[model samples]
Target chain A: MFKKTILLKDTSFSPEDKTRDVFTRCLDYLREKQLEQDIQVVRVADSGVYGQGLVMKVLPDATLYVNLKDEDVTRVIDAAAQNKTIEGLALKKAPKQIRIVLRNCGKIDPESLEEYIATGGYVGLKKALLELTPDKVIEEMKKAGLRGRGGAGYPTWMKWKFARQVVADQKFVICNADEGDPGAYMDRSVLEGDPHSVIEGLIIAAYAVGASKGYFYIRAEYPLAVERIQKAIDQANAAGLLGKNILGSAFSLDLEIRLGAGAFVCGEETALIASIEGRRGTPRPRPPYPSVKGLWDKPTVINNVETLSNVSFILLKGSEQFASIGTEKSKGTKVFAVTGKVKNSGLVEVPMGITLREIVYDIGGGTISGKAVKAVQTGGPSGGVIPVDALDTQVDYENLQKLGSIMGSGGMIVMDEEDCMVDIAKFYLGFCVDESCGKCAPCRIGGYQMLEVLKRVANGQAKLEDMTVLRRISQAMQKASLCGLGQTAANPVLSTMKYFESEYKQHIENKKCPAGKCSALSNYAIIQEKCKRCSLCQKNCPVEAIPGSREDGFTIVQEKCIKCGRCLEVCKFKAVSKT
Target chain B: MDKLTPEAIDRIFKQNRQQSANWIKVGMSTCGIAAGADEVYATLVEEIKKRNIQVTVKKCGCLGMCHAEPLVEVCVDGMPTVIYGRVNKEIAVKILDKHVNSKALLNDYIFDLETK
Candidate 1:
């Protein structure tokens, strides 16, 4: 058996991989020293470090060495064989990701309550029930500085305190699992990976607020999550964790699951409460917020899946430990479902103060297409786009809001150069328009009007005055919208226009999409010099836009051209040009 | 099982704290299952049983690496615990034979994700 393992990868972007060459050289050196059996050499798909030259990580003790040459291979192998470190070559990369909410995600069996307990799960609830009072629990939350992860970063302690102070005979707690963001699946992963944690959080929230009943408002779209949560609730009930006299404490709470019909607006707390009440899912004005009046006209505390997960951790490990991580205002880690144009599209739980650059490059492995990243779209439709220049800004509740983006449900979508800014704004605005409940005019009519103007801009038919009209309408919607959905619907348009104003100007003035994404603004033509007269473009054009024989040479008829890009895709000699 | 008191919870926690050192965990969440983790899990179970390998195969949830799913984590004595990504039936067999039985780490498949 090998005493030590060395994993190698050619991290260079060159077409020819040098992993094999490095591996062979290392193997030969090990053999020469008669240490082949002692040291194991292996090639890896991803060495966790990118853009460096050939990279190798020595295992049993993961000491990474990067930018390696063939000569360095022997030194790396020799160092590993002796379990010694090479001074200049040994690279120590501190991990960018820290899992708090996702602590037991891959560690224990989520379905098994015993495994969860073994991993220090539900211990938080036990402590909350046995040692801490309702006010003490709120104090711990306040000390932890935990905030709601559902777009609006409200203080969790204040929400519980408000509900606790209200003189009501019947109070309720709801776990907002109705995650409706387009690219965000952080909640679903947590619910599926560790359902007990969320349940424990909910029970603790119920205990803290003196509520006897709680509900899990989950979207029906997430069947797996729903199933897992249901199983977990049953297990908790069986173990006397969910039913009356939970952990033999007087704070007994009954929990139930409510399925959403997959409406995006229902993710809002008021709308979620409305949906649970068997009413139309639409947001109402806040003042007598959900903490004061919610679900059947009773004081209710609504916490997000992530927020509750943090609560369990904070209660288990003291408030100081949870508060120690992240920025001052936003404590603990935030889980982001990093999707769209990213190399590794998955759930990443990172501390609040980590930079977007570190999350995108170090954690996400950069963009998938190997193109330059233009911007990152955070906070879903309610949030805004953060330009690449501002990517170095530390990610937190206040910092993201300062960048004109809310940390909305942690749906961070990375946009590369090929993604059109105007088109992206239009897409997000269109999603809001479609999901608008038509209750308030600001969201219903204003969202539709903004979408119409954005469509005109994308089609290259809008005048310069239309940009002003779009802004005016966006401001009106932001000011007058009755609910969070309408109020923040214009965020995408406002933010994209704020950072990518030049791209919009290009679309309006030059009638060109800089990203070449808007088909209506794009025109295709056959480069006469480059064309081989092979009739390939002519044969592939579905609209019959290209008409001419091989001898005559094909030409694209502009009027008939659908701009489908089929000719561009089928062209062999780089004859078809799109501008 | 009855309603667990605080003392009972502590006892259970202590009792289940000591886990088997030699075991294989397959990511069985939606992301992993969608990426064919179920097949990889079945293959590992069958192969280990067929080979009579002294290892336990179990199912867990996603480790946040969805891009390289069907993730299988193997931990055996003398071998460092490693998570292998994009695992299939063939890799499962190789893991049982080479990694489990012979104690050699597989190259190119280990996803070095920092989950601390």
Candidate 2:
């Protein structure tokens, strides 16, 4: 029975939360007017704006007003009660996200073909099969300016054209759902949320490239995504939309699912095809690219899960419409799996040119612990650490690359003050070394050797010259590694060294981990002054490292301590300290 | 199942695509299931049936918010369609009881991403 709804939030980083003050005033005014029943004012955790004071959103109209003064609460209540705008005080919030690829994600029932069709899902497949020719489809793609969403920003139309032009007896269109990036899963969500759209895109790609067979090279890790895709394929086939002759056209295509053995290298297209063909999943040198000779030495077209999902939208709502949303170079929306240390860690699909500040703060709802975000890791291990100062740099293939980071599979991990840069670098480098295929020397040997050097550095056993060795091995891997895996293996280490060398220097020179994350170089102890003879730290110590009871103030046995910080957390009195 | 022609596709789309009156959609993606969305979905279905609420319970894909897995989108007639993130059975029951039946938007759960 409420006539109006107002969303209130104090988005400022200031100590005092003005949200309660604003909410109380609004309620008081409404109660004084005896109109409390007519209006509902709710305080929200996030209003999508950061560092802006007293954000108020009037619902039904969704009129947002930001930076409101204490005096303006009565004015806001009066304006809302009268159903009138507050004129200049009304906040015009420009939407920070665009949803071309994720259009049907939260909106429709993904499992229902009828719901998908209602939302204009397979109309692209219908149009492609009956009306548009292969060349025309590629032409439309070119006009749309669609690029590959699989980190490498290759023009999608050119890849299609190459596959289409190749006169081959058999051609294949593969959906690269092998999203193996550490923090990236935009592909999985799209496949799960809007499976039909990706399927529709795959169908169109099949027709465009004259491919009768297609495979979805999904990783075994994503069981739900696999299940949803299987259900969608079944649904599509049952509806006669995917069989021998789809939509009654001569261009017949059949699709199948292939599970990856959870190898990160398999995300690379050549490695993906090799895995699908029942060969060992490893990247081969690309001489005759996948567009010409791929998947059993036949012509093949491989598009990422996201690129294909955009296909159906492009076909249904013309190429120009799809082209209109994003920046000039990177057209359409890019879905980011925004994770780590951030408050709203999830998938965010924004226009290509939107700043990282907008993405991290406006869309992602800022850092989780209310700490200053140190750096944002993009493109997974293959990408680099972008410091907060450079957050305003437009996110695109070229811009990210210019900042020494590639948009590898859209994994954006935000790191706050607590996360050690050197530790993070070592983790990624170790992942690459672990996942290295060992077919090539640079990736296999270089990745391992570099990881060893990083381990030595983190463990406080390496000299300054060892950093040179790390650099040399990294350069060698970048220049000589067979595939993208070996080539970008050194990114994490190199980027961290570039941005946070002081932290690394502290580890190596001072023999100290600034964040106390590297356990080998750090020690745990109890400060005598702060200890209130509490037995809590003594009891909770897993190793029984604290050798005293409450009678005598507890002291940590340094040798017995694993530096786990168990005592530090267990101590109510500020007794335990790690150094 | 007839092979859909362009004309038939248009007709079927128009006839079938009207907005549903009320429903609960749980994100059934890998992340969501890992966060116990299956149990949530099953509980929602079972609870709605037991309560005899005239609303449909369905499963959808991840809405790209994997951090808050087990996302639930609720759209009831005369209520604003809002997505509730990090939903468990307790929150699901609250969503059904408060949001659906009582017509009140739950506090601290609605994720209003301005998706265009």
Candidate 3:
């Protein structure tokens, strides 16, 4: 039998990689010692540790050694082979992520109800049904301290408790899977990967609030998730996990799937309830929140897919266990769809209070192009930007808000130096404008007007007074918009103007895009010193903007140039430059 | 077909949790499928069955590693569990032939996360 295995990776941010050569030498030394078979040396793609040279994990034993040298390999092998560990070389990396909601994701077969049950999946629902009353369940949730994983970190227990306290003949529970946030797909993955977990959570939630029915408000964009969830519901019904008398208990609940017609505003609970009730997917005033007067004029509990998934785990493992992991205010893990300019762009379920630097550098493997990360955009279009300097800030509800950004949804978009702050703001603002439901005057008109002002700034046509106009409109939208979409429409612009005001000023006053992202403000030309006078630029110019001959030395016509930078690609001597 | 009692549910849960000595799970989520996981899954089943390997081939959801799409995780009783990424038909077969059947590690595909 294989006794031990050593997985090696170079997690060094240092310029040189000495992993392979050093590993080979160590392998050779081990072979010379006739211990090649004793300790299996495997080179891994990632060791979940970054910027530490020559990372090696001795598995079965799991004695991690970092910053190794030529001499340290033999000692590592000897100790690892003997089932012993060296003290100094052992790496004790604090896990950047703490998974509760994603506990079954990639661990169990998503489609297999049996596999889910075996992993103690439905035990939470079982416990909630057999042991706890509705009040008791709410009490446990209150202890666990789980806020919604959806944009607003509202207390989960409060929503349930309020709905439970209300005397409604018919109550409902809705899983808000209408995840339309830019760069966020956490809900989709949870639904597709562990459909049972979310299902079980929803069932427990229904029982806790005395709801007879639950509806999954999933978006039409997620076809596969829809398919998986449908299969799961079918399996649950077949297995008598749903319908009348669930798991041989009187706490019976009926579940259905309601597909959202891909509306961004409908992700809001009020708008989602409106959509479910067959009304136009727009938000009304929220004094009578969903918990008070929801679908069909009855009390309703709307929870994000991730939040419900946590319910089961908290029940199965106990609320204290769940609450112990995260920060004081936010007491659970948050799943971030880490995308854009990051090396490891994926879903990362990190506990609250973990530093943003740890999430981006340790878990995400830093920026994709190896450039210094400029900022991280969390909560999508509705969220504000966090500059690189504040990366060490703990990622909790309050911390993110303190940085002038809300943890809108779990979309954490990494931005490098090449990503112009103004350009980034424009992109998000444009998305909000496009997705705005146009129901409220402030959101409808304010969003369009803000977009126009941003466009003017981007086109190098705006004066500095436009900044005040942007602030004024942002304040109006923030205070007056009906739903989250309209209210946070100005987030991107306001954030960029706050953090990178100089960049915005540069675009307005000097008519220059420092990152050369804004095409109207950018100038494209060939650097005469570096030009090799290659005719490839002239041949490849789409608009015939480069008008000079190879003999006369190629030059870009400033008037005719569309700033497409075609010459930049064709130049072999690195001649073409854009600024 | 029958209303599951609490005892029955417990029994079913117990019966389903099978302990496998060795296995390979491919992330078959939409993100994984879009990145050509279907082909990889089919190849692994075919190759493992053809080779008469004892390792159970299974489908799982996204492990949150979307950038490294088409992720294939291998766990042998003897060796460390590793997630090999960018897997195709060839790598599927290689995993079955080399990682499962042989002792040597496959070149440049192994990703070892701290499995707890």
User: What lDDT score belongs to each candidate, Candidate 1 first?
Assistant: 0.90, 0.86, 0.87
Candidate number achieving the greatest DockQ relative to the actual structure = 1
Residue A395 error for model 2, in Å?
A: 0.5
TM-score of 2: 0.96
Best-fitting candidate, measured by lDDT?
1
Native contact fraction of candidate 3? Answer: 0.77
Per-residue alpha-carbon lDDT of model 3 for A321-343, expressed as tens digits? 99998899999899999999999
Output the lDDT of residue A119, model 1.
Answer: 81
| Candidate 3 pairs with clashing backbones | none
Residue range A1-579, candidate 2, lDDT tens digits: 678878778888888887777777887888899888778777775676777788888888989888888888778878999999999999788777778889988677887888899988888878877888999999999999999999998999999999989998999999999999998888988888889999999999988999999999999988878988999899888778888777777878788999998999998999898999999998899878999999999999999999999888999999999888778888988889999999888888888989998899888878889989999999998989998889999988899998878887899999998888889998998898889989999998898888888888889988888878888888999999899988998998898888888888888899988877899988877789988986898888888888876787778877888888888898888787788
- Winner on lDDT (1 vs 2): 1
Interface RMSD of each: 1.4, 2.0, 2.1
Name the candidate, 2 or 3, with the larger TM-score value.
3
Q: After superposition, how far is residue A488 of candidate 3 from its true place, in Å?
A: 1.7
Cα error of candidate 1 at position A110, Å: 1.1
**Clash count for each candidate, listed in order shown:** 1, 2, 0
Off by over 4 Å in 3: B14-18, B114-116
Model 1 over residues B3-116: C-alpha lDDT tens digits? 777887888888888787999999999999999998998888787778888888888887898999988989999888888999988998998888998888887898877766
Per-candidate DockQ values are 0.73, 0.60, 0.68
lDDT tens per residue, model 1, A223-277 = 9999999999999999999888998888789999999999999998888999999
Error of 3 at A182 (Å): 0.4
